[model samples]
Target: MKKELTADSAAAAARHARYGTLPERIRFEDMTEEVESAPGGAAASYDPEGSWKSYSCLALDLGL
Candidate 1:
């Protein structure tokens, strides 16, 4: 009799195939994360001149 694979089992098999098995001591649920947001907000924090200067191109083409 062939046993049908469940969604969770299929995902677990694929994950093991890609990354191999992880150590038992590591669990994602036990982890804590901290994130800090920009005080001026994302759009207000943009430096257009600084960004454009970083790009290496003979001309800035927008394809317009």
Candidate 2:
């Protein structure tokens, strides 16, 4: 008898071929409204180069 291939089985085989194991951990985090709005606020008023540095430093300060 010929066996039929399945989407789930194909995906699992591909993962094992690439990584030697299936992925086991997954996590998700929500972005806050304030964080989403800050970039637009900064870009409107500040130079682009300086704004990115300032933003990166702010993120580091917050340990994000």
Candidate 3:
């Protein structure tokens, strides 16, 4: 069967492509310049804890 795609699914796919699996943490220095240049830019502080959560929450809020 062919799977249908929705906005949420597309968002999740894009997220996975960019960051791998959920709850995956990424560092500012690790991100590409284009991504870092986008709105909000990179994390100001380098807190290893909960950074993935923050990114996921923000992504959801922004509707991907």
Which TM-score value belongs to model 3?
A: 0.32
Estimate the TM-score of every prediction: 0.33, 0.30, 0.32
Give the higher-lDDT candidate: 2 or 3.
Answer: 3
lDDT of 3 by residue, 13-52 (tens): 9998998966769998788665346554466656788667
Off by over 4 Å in 2: 22-64
Over the stretch 1-64, how does candidate 1's per-residue lDDT look in tens digits? Answer: 9999999999989999999976789568669777898787988968987996677664545543
Candidate 3 local accuracy as lDDT?
Answer: 0.77
Cα TM-score of candidate 2: 0.30
- State which candidate has the highest lDDT: 1
Q: Which candidate model has the greater lDDT, 1 or 2?
A: 1
Query: What is the lDDT for 12 in model 2?
Result: 83
Q: Write candidate 2's Cα lDDT for 1-64 as tens digits.
A: 9887799988988888888965565554443334445556755776766656545566778889
Error of 3 at 18 (Å): 0.2
User: Per TM-score, what order, best first?
Assistant: 1, 3, 2
